[model samples]
Target: MERLVNQDASERNAVEGKFGEGKRKYGLDLIRARLQETSETVIALQFLIMNLGRKLRVLFFKFLQNTILSFDN
Candidate 1:
């Protein structure tokens, strides 16, 4: 159906955007490990770092909000 197609396209765009971000900012395009295991490890680490960065940003915003509120009181 048309609805299904739209949903698929939306999902695909989000996935592709993540890949582009990884390649551009995380050196994903530079991976050169020869062995399958090593390549997998490197990719896994890159994704892990990406996840940690997202978490840190969330935490930082929360901290900043609290700091600003404390200053108001």
Candidate 2:
């Protein structure tokens, strides 16, 4: 169905966007590992770093929000 196709495309776009971000921002586009294992490790580590960065950002903002709220009490 057309709806299913649209959904698939949307999902694909989201995934591709993440890949682009990883490559552009995290140096994933410059991977030069020749071995399969090394390549996989590099990819995994890149994603792990990206995920950790996002988590830290979220935690930091939440802490900032709470601190500001406490000041108003």
Candidate 3:
């Protein structure tokens, strides 16, 4: 990564040595990916809920109309 960055960049870029596997670096990436997926799931669930509410409202109105008409008979 450092080598590729230095080639494209006009100024000198500092390169770091090999990083050992540990809880810090790997944990942070995993946390970020999980947060991204959670946000997407929340949005999808919200969309589904909104559609369901609309359908329920339509059904309620239909039932109300049927009740009123039957009472007039």
Candidate 4:
């Protein structure tokens, strides 16, 4: 269906965007590991770091919001 196609495209875009971000911001683009296992590990670590960064940002924004609200009370 057309709806399903649109949903798939949206999901693909989000995934691709994250990969692009990883390569650009992290050292994903510079990975020089020749072994398959080592390359996989490097990729996994990069994604893990990316996830941790995203989580920290979310937590920071929540803390900022709480601080601002407390001042308004």
List TM-scores for all candidates, in order.
Answer: 0.92, 0.95, 0.52, 0.85
Q: List the global CA lDDT of all models.
A: 0.98, 0.97, 0.56, 0.96
Kindly report which residue stretches of model 2 are placed more than 4 angstroms away from their true locations once superposed: none
For residues 1-73, what per-residue lDDT tens digits would candidate 1 score against the true structure?
A: 9999999999999999998999999999999999999999999999999999999999999999999999999
**TM accuracy, model 3:** 0.52
- Tell me how far candidate 2 lies from the true structure as C-alpha RMSD in angstroms: 0.7
The local lDDT score (0 to 100) that residue 29 gets in candidate 1 is: 95
User: What lDDT tens digits, residue by residue, belong to model 4 across residues 1-73?
Assistant: 9999999999999999998999999968999999999999999999999999999999999999999999999
Give the candidate number with the greatest lDDT.
Answer: 1
The full ranking of all candidates by lDDT, starting with the best, is 1, 2, 4, 3
lDDT computed for candidate 3: 0.56
Off by over 4 Å in 4: none
Residue-by-residue lDDT tens digits, candidate 3, 1-73: 9987768663433112111221233332233334868856664554566557779999999999999999999
Candidate 4 has its poorest 10 consecutive residues by lDDT at 19-28
How many clashes in candidate 3? 0
